[model samples]
Target: MNSKKSKYHLLVLMDLSKASEAALKNAVHLAKEINGKVEVFHVKSPADVAKYENQFSAMRAIQEDTSNVQSKLMKLIREIEKEEKVVITLQISYGNAKQAIKDKIDSVKPDLVILGKRKNNLMNFLEPDITKFVLKECNANILISGEDNKFHSFDDISLGVYGETIHKEGLEIISDLKTNEEDPIRFFRIRNPNNSDKSVTTEQNKKWAVSYTFSEGENALDGLASYITGTNTQLFCIPRKQNENASWFGLSRINDLIYKLNIPVLILR
Candidate 1:
Protein backbone atom coordinates (compact mmCIF):
# COMPACT_ATOMS: atom_id res chain seq x y z
CA MET A 1 0.00 0.00 0.00
CA ASN A 2 1.23 3.46 -0.88
CA SER A 3 1.72 5.56 2.27
CA LYS A 4 1.56 8.94 0.57
CA LYS A 5 -1.07 11.39 1.78
CA SER A 6 -3.88 11.90 -0.69
CA LYS A 7 -4.05 15.32 -2.34
CA TYR A 8 -7.26 16.17 -4.19
CA HIS A 9 -7.48 18.41 -7.26
CA LEU A 10 -10.61 18.91 -9.39
CA LEU A 11 -11.63 20.40 -12.73
CA VAL A 12 -15.28 21.45 -13.11
CA LEU A 13 -17.01 22.07 -16.48
CA MET A 14 -19.20 25.15 -16.27
CA ASP A 15 -21.72 26.70 -18.72
CA LEU A 16 -23.64 29.14 -16.46
CA SER A 17 -26.70 26.93 -16.80
CA LYS A 18 -29.10 26.10 -13.99
CA ALA A 19 -27.97 22.45 -13.97
CA SER A 20 -24.39 23.48 -13.15
CA GLU A 21 -24.94 25.26 -9.83
CA ALA A 22 -25.46 22.13 -7.75
CA ALA A 23 -22.34 20.52 -9.23
CA LEU A 24 -20.27 23.64 -8.70
CA LYS A 25 -21.34 23.91 -5.08
CA ASN A 26 -20.62 20.24 -4.53
CA ALA A 27 -17.19 20.61 -6.13
CA VAL A 28 -16.38 23.59 -3.89
CA HIS A 29 -17.34 21.68 -0.76
CA LEU A 30 -15.24 18.72 -1.87
CA ALA A 31 -12.26 20.99 -2.56
CA LYS A 32 -12.53 22.48 0.90
CA GLU A 33 -12.77 19.12 2.62
CA ILE A 34 -9.85 17.58 0.72
CA ASN A 35 -7.56 20.67 0.75
CA GLY A 36 -7.56 20.78 -3.03
CA LYS A 37 -7.60 23.21 -5.93
CA VAL A 38 -10.55 23.75 -8.28
CA GLU A 39 -10.25 24.79 -11.90
CA VAL A 40 -13.42 25.94 -13.69
CA PHE A 41 -13.51 25.73 -17.48
CA HIS A 42 -15.99 27.46 -19.82
CA VAL A 43 -15.56 26.67 -23.51
CA LYS A 44 -16.72 29.06 -26.23
CA SER A 45 -16.84 28.22 -29.91
CA PRO A 46 -16.02 31.19 -32.18
CA ALA A 47 -17.45 29.36 -35.20
CA ASP A 48 -20.80 29.09 -33.48
CA VAL A 49 -20.83 32.83 -32.89
CA ALA A 50 -19.95 33.52 -36.53
CA LYS A 51 -22.50 31.05 -37.79
CA TYR A 52 -25.23 32.69 -35.72
CA GLU A 53 -24.01 36.26 -36.18
CA ASN A 54 -27.28 37.38 -37.80
CA GLN A 55 -29.21 35.71 -34.99
CA PHE A 56 -26.89 36.95 -32.23
CA SER A 57 -24.68 40.04 -32.23
CA ALA A 58 -20.90 40.47 -31.96
CA MET A 59 -18.42 37.88 -30.65
CA ARG A 60 -17.47 40.45 -28.04
CA ALA A 61 -20.99 40.17 -26.63
CA ILE A 62 -20.63 36.41 -26.28
CA GLN A 63 -17.22 36.86 -24.67
CA GLU A 64 -18.69 39.35 -22.24
CA ASP A 65 -21.42 36.89 -21.28
CA THR A 66 -18.81 34.22 -20.65
CA SER A 67 -16.78 36.65 -18.55
CA ASN A 68 -19.85 37.47 -16.48
CA VAL A 69 -20.48 33.82 -15.90
CA GLN A 70 -16.86 33.33 -14.81
CA SER A 71 -17.20 36.26 -12.41
CA LYS A 72 -20.26 34.73 -10.75
CA LEU A 73 -18.46 31.37 -10.52
CA MET A 74 -15.43 33.05 -8.94
CA LYS A 75 -17.69 34.73 -6.40
CA LEU A 76 -19.00 31.35 -5.33
CA ILE A 77 -15.45 30.01 -5.11
CA ARG A 78 -14.51 32.99 -2.95
CA GLU A 79 -17.36 32.20 -0.59
CA ILE A 80 -16.06 28.67 -0.19
CA GLU A 81 -12.48 29.92 0.20
CA LYS A 82 -13.47 32.40 2.90
CA GLU A 83 -14.66 29.51 5.00
CA GLU A 84 -11.82 27.11 4.11
CA LYS A 85 -8.48 26.92 2.35
CA VAL A 86 -8.79 26.23 -1.39
CA VAL A 87 -7.09 27.53 -4.54
CA ILE A 88 -9.45 28.43 -7.38
CA THR A 89 -8.65 29.20 -11.02
CA LEU A 90 -10.93 29.97 -13.97
CA GLN A 91 -10.32 29.59 -17.72
CA ILE A 92 -12.41 30.70 -20.68
CA SER A 93 -11.42 29.17 -23.99
CA TYR A 94 -12.52 29.40 -27.63
CA GLY A 95 -12.73 26.02 -29.37
CA ASN A 96 -14.65 22.76 -29.32
CA ALA A 97 -15.81 21.92 -25.81
CA LYS A 98 -14.32 18.42 -25.68
CA GLN A 99 -11.03 19.47 -27.23
CA ALA A 100 -10.71 22.40 -24.86
CA ILE A 101 -11.41 20.20 -21.88
CA LYS A 102 -8.95 17.57 -23.05
CA ASP A 103 -6.26 20.23 -23.50
CA LYS A 104 -6.93 21.56 -20.03
CA ILE A 105 -6.79 18.06 -18.57
CA ASP A 106 -3.41 17.53 -20.21
CA SER A 107 -2.04 20.82 -18.85
CA VAL A 108 -3.71 20.94 -15.43
CA LYS A 109 -3.89 17.18 -14.73
CA PRO A 110 -6.50 17.37 -12.03
CA ASP A 111 -7.34 14.25 -10.03
CA LEU A 112 -11.03 14.39 -10.91
CA VAL A 113 -13.45 16.29 -13.16
CA ILE A 114 -16.94 17.29 -12.06
CA LEU A 115 -19.76 17.59 -14.58
CA GLY A 116 -23.51 18.17 -14.43
CA LYS A 117 -25.96 15.78 -16.08
CA ARG A 118 -28.16 17.92 -18.27
CA LYS A 119 -31.67 16.95 -19.26
CA ASN A 120 -32.01 14.79 -22.37
CA ASN A 121 -33.78 17.09 -24.80
CA LEU A 122 -33.26 19.34 -27.77
CA MET A 123 -31.20 21.66 -25.59
CA ASN A 124 -28.58 18.93 -25.37
CA PHE A 125 -27.48 19.87 -28.87
CA LEU A 126 -26.62 23.38 -27.71
CA GLU A 127 -25.20 22.20 -24.39
CA PRO A 128 -22.55 19.75 -25.58
CA ASP A 129 -22.17 16.42 -23.81
CA ILE A 130 -18.63 16.98 -22.54
CA THR A 131 -18.92 14.35 -19.83
CA LYS A 132 -19.40 11.54 -22.29
CA PHE A 133 -16.45 12.67 -24.34
CA VAL A 134 -14.22 13.05 -21.31
CA LEU A 135 -15.16 9.61 -20.05
CA LYS A 136 -14.15 8.05 -23.33
CA GLU A 137 -11.04 10.10 -24.02
CA CYS A 138 -9.49 11.44 -20.81
CA ASN A 139 -7.62 9.30 -18.28
CA ALA A 140 -8.81 11.40 -15.36
CA ASN A 141 -11.49 10.35 -12.88
CA ILE A 142 -14.93 11.97 -13.29
CA LEU A 143 -17.83 12.87 -11.03
CA ILE A 144 -21.25 13.48 -12.60
CA SER A 145 -23.51 15.52 -10.33
CA GLY A 146 -27.24 14.88 -10.33
CA GLU A 147 -30.14 17.16 -9.25
CA ASP A 148 -29.67 16.05 -5.64
CA ASN A 149 -27.24 18.24 -3.68
CA LYS A 150 -25.96 15.66 -1.25
CA PHE A 151 -22.23 15.05 -0.70
CA HIS A 152 -20.85 11.51 -0.33
CA SER A 153 -17.70 10.20 1.33
CA PHE A 154 -15.33 7.74 -0.34
CA ASP A 155 -14.78 5.72 2.83
CA ASP A 156 -15.97 2.12 3.01
CA ILE A 157 -15.75 1.77 -0.74
CA SER A 158 -16.40 -1.21 -2.99
CA LEU A 159 -14.44 -2.45 -5.99
CA GLY A 160 -16.35 -4.59 -8.51
CA VAL A 161 -13.65 -6.69 -10.16
CA TYR A 162 -14.15 -8.66 -13.34
CA GLY A 163 -11.53 -10.21 -15.63
CA GLU A 164 -7.87 -10.66 -14.69
CA THR A 165 -6.96 -7.61 -16.75
CA ILE A 166 -8.23 -5.24 -14.02
CA HIS A 167 -6.77 -7.09 -11.02
CA LYS A 168 -3.55 -5.12 -10.58
CA GLU A 169 -5.10 -1.67 -10.96
CA GLY A 170 -8.02 -2.57 -8.74
CA LEU A 171 -5.72 -3.77 -5.99
CA GLU A 172 -3.61 -0.64 -6.24
CA ILE A 173 -6.66 1.61 -5.85
CA ILE A 174 -7.97 -0.41 -2.92
CA SER A 175 -4.55 -0.36 -1.29
CA ASP A 176 -4.28 3.39 -1.58
CA LEU A 177 -7.80 3.95 -0.25
CA LYS A 178 -7.19 1.56 2.60
CA THR A 179 -3.95 3.30 3.54
CA ASN A 180 -5.93 6.52 3.83
CA GLU A 181 -8.20 4.85 6.38
CA GLU A 182 -10.92 4.23 3.81
CA ASP A 183 -11.25 0.71 5.10
CA PRO A 184 -13.61 -2.23 4.79
CA ILE A 185 -12.92 -2.62 1.09
CA ARG A 186 -15.32 -5.13 -0.37
CA PHE A 187 -14.63 -7.05 -3.59
CA PHE A 188 -17.42 -8.54 -5.75
CA ARG A 189 -16.72 -10.92 -8.63
CA ILE A 190 -19.35 -11.48 -11.27
CA ARG A 191 -20.18 -15.14 -11.51
CA ASN A 192 -19.10 -16.82 -14.73
CA PRO A 193 -18.97 -20.43 -15.78
CA ASN A 194 -15.89 -20.20 -17.97
CA ASN A 195 -14.08 -17.94 -15.49
CA SER A 196 -14.05 -20.36 -12.60
CA ASP A 197 -10.26 -20.20 -12.63
CA LYS A 198 -10.30 -16.41 -12.37
CA SER A 199 -12.71 -16.57 -9.42
CA VAL A 200 -10.37 -18.90 -7.61
CA THR A 201 -7.49 -16.48 -8.19
CA THR A 202 -9.51 -13.54 -6.74
CA GLU A 203 -10.60 -15.48 -3.66
CA GLN A 204 -6.96 -15.91 -2.65
CA ASN A 205 -6.78 -12.29 -1.49
CA LYS A 206 -8.16 -12.30 2.07
CA LYS A 207 -6.76 -8.97 3.23
CA TRP A 208 -10.20 -7.32 2.94
CA ALA A 209 -13.70 -8.70 3.30
CA VAL A 210 -14.56 -10.23 -0.09
CA SER A 211 -17.81 -11.49 -1.52
CA TYR A 212 -18.78 -13.35 -4.67
CA THR A 213 -22.02 -12.98 -6.54
CA PHE A 214 -23.49 -14.23 -9.80
CA SER A 215 -24.35 -11.64 -12.43
CA GLU A 216 -26.93 -13.15 -14.75
CA GLY A 217 -26.13 -10.67 -17.49
CA GLU A 218 -23.07 -9.00 -19.02
CA ASN A 219 -23.84 -5.63 -17.44
CA ALA A 220 -21.43 -5.60 -14.50
CA LEU A 221 -22.69 -2.25 -13.25
CA ASP A 222 -26.23 -3.50 -12.71
CA GLY A 223 -25.03 -6.65 -10.97
CA LEU A 224 -22.70 -4.75 -8.64
CA ALA A 225 -25.36 -2.14 -7.84
CA SER A 226 -27.88 -4.85 -7.07
CA TYR A 227 -25.47 -6.69 -4.78
CA ILE A 228 -24.39 -3.61 -2.81
CA THR A 229 -27.54 -1.51 -2.66
CA GLY A 230 -28.68 -0.50 0.89
CA THR A 231 -25.13 -0.93 2.17
CA ASN A 232 -23.30 2.17 3.47
CA THR A 233 -20.98 2.12 0.46
CA GLN A 234 -20.25 5.69 -0.59
CA LEU A 235 -17.92 5.22 -3.57
CA PHE A 236 -17.39 2.55 -6.20
CA CYS A 237 -13.80 2.25 -7.49
CA ILE A 238 -12.71 0.78 -10.83
CA PRO A 239 -9.64 0.54 -13.04
CA ARG A 240 -9.25 1.80 -16.61
CA LYS A 241 -8.48 -0.98 -19.08
CA GLN A 242 -7.13 -0.25 -22.53
CA ASN A 243 -7.07 -3.28 -24.81
CA GLU A 244 -4.48 -4.08 -27.46
CA ASN A 245 -6.76 -2.39 -29.98
CA ALA A 246 -6.82 0.67 -27.67
CA SER A 247 -10.46 0.30 -26.66
CA TRP A 248 -11.40 1.10 -23.04
CA PHE A 249 -13.92 -1.21 -21.36
CA GLY A 250 -13.42 -0.06 -17.75
CA LEU A 251 -14.18 3.56 -18.60
CA SER A 252 -17.33 2.67 -20.53
CA ARG A 253 -18.68 0.73 -17.58
CA ILE A 254 -17.67 3.44 -15.14
CA ASN A 255 -19.51 6.05 -17.18
CA ASP A 256 -22.63 3.93 -17.20
CA LEU A 257 -22.46 3.56 -13.41
CA ILE A 258 -21.80 7.27 -12.87
CA TYR A 259 -24.98 8.37 -14.62
CA LYS A 260 -27.13 5.52 -13.33
CA LEU A 261 -26.10 5.43 -9.68
CA ASN A 262 -26.59 8.12 -7.03
CA ILE A 263 -23.19 7.50 -5.44
CA PRO A 264 -19.95 9.10 -6.51
CA VAL A 265 -17.40 6.93 -8.44
CA LEU A 266 -13.59 6.89 -8.41
CA ILE A 267 -11.67 5.58 -11.42
CA LEU A 268 -7.91 5.05 -11.61
CA ARG A 269 -5.95 4.78 -14.81
Candidate 2:
Protein backbone atom coordinates (compact mmCIF):
# COMPACT_ATOMS: atom_id res chain seq x y z
CA MET A 1 0.00 0.00 0.00
CA ASN A 2 2.93 2.36 0.57
CA SER A 3 4.34 1.88 -2.93
CA LYS A 4 4.04 4.88 -5.22
CA LYS A 5 1.18 4.87 -7.74
CA SER A 6 2.08 2.88 -10.83
CA LYS A 7 1.93 4.57 -14.23
CA TYR A 8 1.19 1.30 -16.03
CA HIS A 9 -1.79 -0.76 -14.90
CA LEU A 10 -2.08 -4.47 -15.66
CA LEU A 11 -5.50 -6.06 -15.29
CA VAL A 12 -5.40 -9.83 -14.80
CA LEU A 13 -8.35 -12.16 -15.18
CA MET A 14 -8.48 -14.99 -12.68
CA ASP A 15 -10.78 -17.94 -13.14
CA LEU A 16 -9.42 -19.77 -10.06
CA SER A 17 -7.70 -22.23 -12.36
CA LYS A 18 -4.03 -23.14 -11.91
CA ALA A 19 -3.38 -21.03 -15.00
CA SER A 20 -4.99 -18.05 -13.29
CA GLU A 21 -2.49 -18.18 -10.45
CA ALA A 22 0.37 -18.29 -12.93
CA ALA A 23 -1.09 -15.29 -14.74
CA LEU A 24 -1.24 -13.27 -11.52
CA LYS A 25 2.30 -14.18 -10.53
CA ASN A 26 3.50 -13.44 -14.04
CA ALA A 27 1.66 -10.12 -13.96
CA VAL A 28 3.59 -9.20 -10.86
CA HIS A 29 6.81 -10.16 -12.61
CA LEU A 30 5.86 -7.98 -15.58
CA ALA A 31 4.93 -5.12 -13.23
CA LYS A 32 8.54 -4.79 -12.19
CA GLU A 33 9.65 -4.27 -15.77
CA ILE A 34 6.89 -1.93 -16.83
CA ASN A 35 6.56 0.08 -13.61
CA GLY A 36 3.07 -1.38 -13.48
CA LYS A 37 0.61 -2.50 -10.80
CA VAL A 38 -1.71 -5.46 -10.96
CA GLU A 39 -5.46 -5.63 -10.61
CA VAL A 40 -6.89 -9.17 -10.41
CA PHE A 41 -10.44 -9.53 -11.65
CA HIS A 42 -12.71 -12.56 -11.20
CA VAL A 43 -16.20 -12.92 -12.58
CA LYS A 44 -18.84 -15.60 -12.10
CA SER A 45 -22.36 -16.10 -13.33
CA PRO A 46 -25.01 -15.90 -10.58
CA ALA A 47 -27.83 -16.94 -12.91
CA ASP A 48 -27.86 -20.45 -11.52
CA VAL A 49 -28.58 -19.12 -8.05
CA ALA A 50 -30.63 -16.11 -9.17
CA LYS A 51 -34.03 -17.76 -8.97
CA TYR A 52 -33.42 -18.27 -5.27
CA GLU A 53 -32.24 -14.69 -4.67
CA ASN A 54 -35.86 -13.81 -3.81
CA GLN A 55 -35.63 -16.32 -1.00
CA PHE A 56 -33.87 -14.86 2.05
CA SER A 57 -32.01 -18.11 2.71
CA ALA A 58 -30.77 -18.41 -0.88
CA MET A 59 -29.78 -14.74 -0.97
CA ARG A 60 -27.63 -15.33 2.10
CA ALA A 61 -26.04 -18.31 0.38
CA ILE A 62 -25.16 -16.22 -2.66
CA GLN A 63 -23.70 -13.46 -0.51
CA GLU A 64 -21.66 -16.02 1.44
CA ASP A 65 -20.26 -17.44 -1.77
CA THR A 66 -19.23 -14.00 -2.94
CA SER A 67 -17.68 -13.19 0.41
CA ASN A 68 -15.66 -16.40 0.44
CA VAL A 69 -14.25 -15.74 -3.03
CA GLN A 70 -13.38 -12.17 -2.08
CA SER A 71 -11.52 -13.43 0.99
CA LYS A 72 -9.51 -15.92 -1.03
CA LEU A 73 -8.57 -13.29 -3.64
CA MET A 74 -7.56 -10.80 -0.95
CA LYS A 75 -5.29 -13.39 0.65
CA LEU A 76 -3.67 -14.17 -2.67
CA ILE A 77 -3.18 -10.48 -3.50
CA ARG A 78 -1.62 -9.74 -0.12
CA GLU A 79 0.85 -12.58 -0.49
CA ILE A 80 1.85 -11.57 -4.02
CA GLU A 81 2.24 -7.90 -3.13
CA LYS A 82 4.33 -8.65 -0.07
CA GLU A 83 6.63 -11.09 -1.84
CA GLU A 84 6.94 -9.16 -5.12
CA LYS A 85 7.23 -5.73 -3.49
CA VAL A 86 4.49 -4.40 -5.74
CA VAL A 87 0.93 -3.16 -5.32
CA ILE A 88 -2.00 -5.39 -6.35
CA THR A 89 -5.78 -5.09 -5.92
CA LEU A 90 -8.71 -7.43 -6.65
CA GLN A 91 -12.09 -6.90 -8.33
CA ILE A 92 -14.92 -9.40 -8.10
CA SER A 93 -18.26 -9.43 -9.86
CA TYR A 94 -21.00 -11.88 -10.82
CA GLY A 95 -22.07 -12.08 -14.43
CA ASN A 96 -21.01 -13.50 -17.79
CA ALA A 97 -17.24 -13.78 -17.56
CA LYS A 98 -16.47 -12.46 -21.06
CA GLN A 99 -18.85 -9.51 -20.87
CA ALA A 100 -17.72 -8.64 -17.38
CA ILE A 101 -14.12 -8.54 -18.55
CA LYS A 102 -15.02 -6.29 -21.46
CA ASP A 103 -16.88 -3.99 -19.08
CA LYS A 104 -13.92 -3.87 -16.74
CA ILE A 105 -11.57 -2.97 -19.61
CA ASP A 106 -13.87 -0.14 -20.63
CA SER A 107 -14.21 1.21 -17.12
CA VAL A 108 -10.66 0.74 -15.84
CA LYS A 109 -8.85 1.17 -19.15
CA PRO A 110 -5.81 -0.81 -18.01
CA ASP A 111 -2.79 -0.73 -20.30
CA LEU A 112 -2.76 -4.49 -20.50
CA VAL A 113 -5.00 -7.45 -19.64
CA ILE A 114 -3.25 -10.62 -18.49
CA LEU A 115 -5.17 -13.85 -19.00
CA GLY A 116 -4.30 -17.37 -17.87
CA LYS A 117 -5.08 -20.34 -20.05
CA ARG A 118 -4.46 -24.08 -20.13
CA LYS A 119 -4.57 -26.68 -22.89
CA ASN A 120 -8.26 -27.07 -23.58
CA ASN A 121 -9.40 -29.86 -25.88
CA LEU A 122 -12.87 -28.36 -25.80
CA MET A 123 -11.87 -24.85 -26.77
CA ASN A 124 -13.57 -25.16 -30.13
CA PHE A 125 -16.83 -26.10 -28.49
CA LEU A 126 -16.44 -23.67 -25.63
CA GLU A 127 -18.22 -20.66 -27.07
CA PRO A 128 -16.73 -17.32 -26.11
CA ASP A 129 -13.44 -18.56 -24.67
CA ILE A 130 -11.65 -15.75 -22.85
CA THR A 131 -8.79 -15.52 -25.35
CA LYS A 132 -11.09 -15.39 -28.32
CA PHE A 133 -13.48 -12.96 -26.70
CA VAL A 134 -10.75 -10.60 -25.65
CA LEU A 135 -9.00 -10.79 -29.01
CA LYS A 136 -12.17 -9.95 -30.87
CA GLU A 137 -14.13 -7.80 -28.47
CA CYS A 138 -11.74 -6.12 -26.07
CA ASN A 139 -9.53 -3.26 -27.18
CA ALA A 140 -6.83 -3.68 -24.53
CA ASN A 141 -3.53 -5.37 -25.31
CA ILE A 142 -3.54 -8.93 -23.94
CA LEU A 143 -0.96 -11.24 -22.40
CA ILE A 144 -2.01 -14.88 -22.30
CA SER A 145 -0.07 -16.88 -19.74
CA GLY A 146 -0.05 -20.62 -20.04
CA GLU A 147 -0.37 -22.72 -16.91
CA ASP A 148 3.26 -23.83 -17.04
CA ASN A 149 4.81 -20.36 -17.55
CA LYS A 150 7.84 -19.83 -15.29
CA PHE A 151 7.15 -16.08 -14.87
CA HIS A 152 10.82 -15.30 -15.25
CA SER A 153 12.04 -11.84 -16.24
CA PHE A 154 11.79 -11.22 -19.98
CA ASP A 155 15.49 -11.61 -20.58
CA ASP A 156 14.93 -13.29 -23.93
CA ILE A 157 11.90 -12.20 -25.96
CA SER A 158 10.67 -13.04 -29.47
CA LEU A 159 8.29 -11.12 -31.67
CA GLY A 160 6.41 -13.21 -34.25
CA VAL A 161 5.76 -11.27 -37.41
CA TYR A 162 3.11 -12.87 -39.56
CA GLY A 163 2.66 -9.88 -41.82
CA GLU A 164 3.47 -6.22 -42.30
CA THR A 165 1.05 -3.70 -40.82
CA ILE A 166 -0.49 -5.40 -37.79
CA HIS A 167 2.67 -7.17 -36.74
CA LYS A 168 4.97 -4.14 -37.04
CA GLU A 169 2.98 -2.37 -34.36
CA GLY A 170 3.75 -5.22 -31.97
CA LEU A 171 7.38 -4.18 -31.93
CA GLU A 172 6.50 -0.74 -30.61
CA ILE A 173 4.13 -2.19 -28.01
CA ILE A 174 6.60 -4.76 -26.68
CA SER A 175 9.35 -2.14 -26.46
CA ASP A 176 7.26 -0.27 -23.92
CA LEU A 177 7.30 -3.34 -21.67
CA LYS A 178 11.04 -3.55 -21.32
CA THR A 179 12.75 -1.90 -18.33
CA ASN A 180 16.25 -3.11 -19.17
CA GLU A 181 17.51 -1.16 -22.13
CA GLU A 182 19.91 -3.95 -22.99
CA ASP A 183 17.33 -6.73 -23.10
CA PRO A 184 17.41 -8.51 -26.44
CA ILE A 185 14.34 -9.04 -28.66
CA ARG A 186 14.59 -10.87 -31.94
CA PHE A 187 12.02 -11.59 -34.60
CA PHE A 188 10.60 -14.99 -35.48
CA ARG A 189 9.61 -13.82 -38.94
CA ILE A 190 6.76 -16.06 -40.07
CA ARG A 191 7.31 -16.68 -43.75
CA ASN A 192 3.89 -17.09 -45.29
CA PRO A 193 5.20 -18.71 -48.45
CA ASN A 194 1.81 -17.84 -49.83
CA ASN A 195 2.16 -14.09 -49.53
CA SER A 196 5.36 -12.72 -51.08
CA ASP A 197 4.19 -9.13 -50.80
CA LYS A 198 4.00 -9.09 -47.02
CA SER A 199 7.38 -8.62 -45.34
CA VAL A 200 9.07 -6.62 -42.64
CA THR A 201 10.66 -3.35 -43.75
CA THR A 202 14.19 -2.24 -42.85
CA GLU A 203 12.81 0.18 -40.29
CA GLN A 204 10.76 -2.63 -38.74
CA ASN A 205 13.79 -4.89 -38.64
CA LYS A 206 15.73 -2.17 -36.82
CA LYS A 207 12.83 -1.51 -34.47
CA TRP A 208 12.60 -5.29 -34.17
CA ALA A 209 16.18 -5.18 -32.77
CA VAL A 210 17.11 -8.51 -34.47
CA SER A 211 15.66 -11.23 -36.63
CA TYR A 212 15.27 -15.00 -37.09
CA THR A 213 13.31 -16.54 -39.89
CA PHE A 214 10.76 -19.25 -39.21
CA SER A 215 11.62 -22.52 -40.89
CA GLU A 216 9.84 -22.57 -44.21
CA GLY A 217 9.22 -26.28 -43.90
CA GLU A 218 7.24 -25.81 -40.73
CA ASN A 219 3.71 -24.49 -40.58
CA ALA A 220 3.01 -21.15 -38.90
CA LEU A 221 1.96 -22.57 -35.56
CA ASP A 222 4.61 -25.28 -35.67
CA GLY A 223 7.41 -22.77 -36.30
CA LEU A 224 6.15 -20.57 -33.49
CA ALA A 225 5.97 -23.51 -31.07
CA SER A 226 9.45 -24.65 -32.07
CA TYR A 227 11.03 -21.23 -31.55
CA ILE A 228 9.35 -20.52 -28.23
CA THR A 229 10.20 -23.98 -26.90
CA GLY A 230 13.65 -24.19 -28.42
CA THR A 231 14.89 -20.84 -27.19
CA ASN A 232 15.06 -19.21 -23.75
CA THR A 233 12.37 -16.83 -24.97
CA GLN A 234 10.22 -16.16 -21.91
CA LEU A 235 7.78 -13.93 -23.71
CA PHE A 236 6.44 -13.93 -27.31
CA CYS A 237 4.92 -10.74 -28.72
CA ILE A 238 2.60 -10.63 -31.73
CA PRO A 239 -0.50 -8.85 -32.89
CA ARG A 240 -3.93 -10.45 -32.77
CA LYS A 241 -4.64 -10.10 -36.47
CA GLN A 242 -2.02 -11.47 -38.79
CA ASN A 243 -2.82 -9.00 -41.58
CA GLU A 244 -5.00 -6.06 -42.53
CA ASN A 245 -7.67 -8.35 -43.92
CA ALA A 246 -7.33 -10.46 -40.80
CA SER A 247 -6.77 -13.35 -43.16
CA TRP A 248 -5.18 -16.07 -41.02
CA PHE A 249 -4.20 -16.75 -37.41
CA GLY A 250 -6.78 -14.15 -36.60
CA LEU A 251 -8.41 -16.23 -33.93
CA SER A 252 -8.44 -20.00 -34.45
CA ARG A 253 -4.71 -20.50 -34.97
CA ILE A 254 -3.68 -18.18 -32.11
CA ASN A 255 -6.37 -19.60 -29.85
CA ASP A 256 -5.22 -23.11 -30.65
CA LEU A 257 -1.62 -22.12 -29.95
CA ILE A 258 -2.56 -20.63 -26.59
CA TYR A 259 -3.83 -23.97 -25.26
CA LYS A 260 -0.97 -25.94 -26.76
CA LEU A 261 2.00 -23.72 -25.91
CA ASN A 262 2.92 -23.43 -22.26
CA ILE A 263 4.54 -20.00 -22.66
CA PRO A 264 3.41 -16.41 -22.21
CA VAL A 265 2.32 -14.63 -25.41
CA LEU A 266 1.55 -10.94 -25.59
CA ILE A 267 -1.10 -10.37 -28.27
CA LEU A 268 -1.26 -6.71 -29.25
CA ARG A 269 -4.59 -5.29 -30.32
Q: Which has the greatest TM-score?
A: 2
Residue 205's lDDT within candidate 1 is 44
Please report how far candidate 1 places residue 187 from its true position, in Å.
2.0
Q: Which residue pairs collide, candidate 2?
A: none
Candidate 1, residue 193: how far the Cα is off, in Å = 2.1
Candidate 2 lDDT for residue 4: 70
Give the per-residue lDDT of model 1 (tens digit) for 79-179. Answer: 76675455567787877777877899998888878876554311131344556577778977676665465544433335444333445634543454444
The digit string of per-residue lDDT tens for model 2 on 1-269 reads: 44776767899888666667878898888777666888888887776445674678777767888898888888888888888777788878887777787899999998888877665531221234556778778887888875574665643344443334434445455655543445445555555466554444434334544456643343667766777677756666666655432555557766666665666777777
In model 1, which regions exceed 4 Å deviation? 1-6, 32-34, 47-57, 118-128, 154-183, 197-205, 216-221, 242-252
Native RMSD of candidate 2 (Å): 3.6
* Model 1: ten consecutive residues of lowest lDDT: 119-128
**177 in model 2: Cα distance from truth in Å?**
3.4
- Compared with the true structure, model 2 gives a TM-score of 0.82
Clashes of each: 0, 0
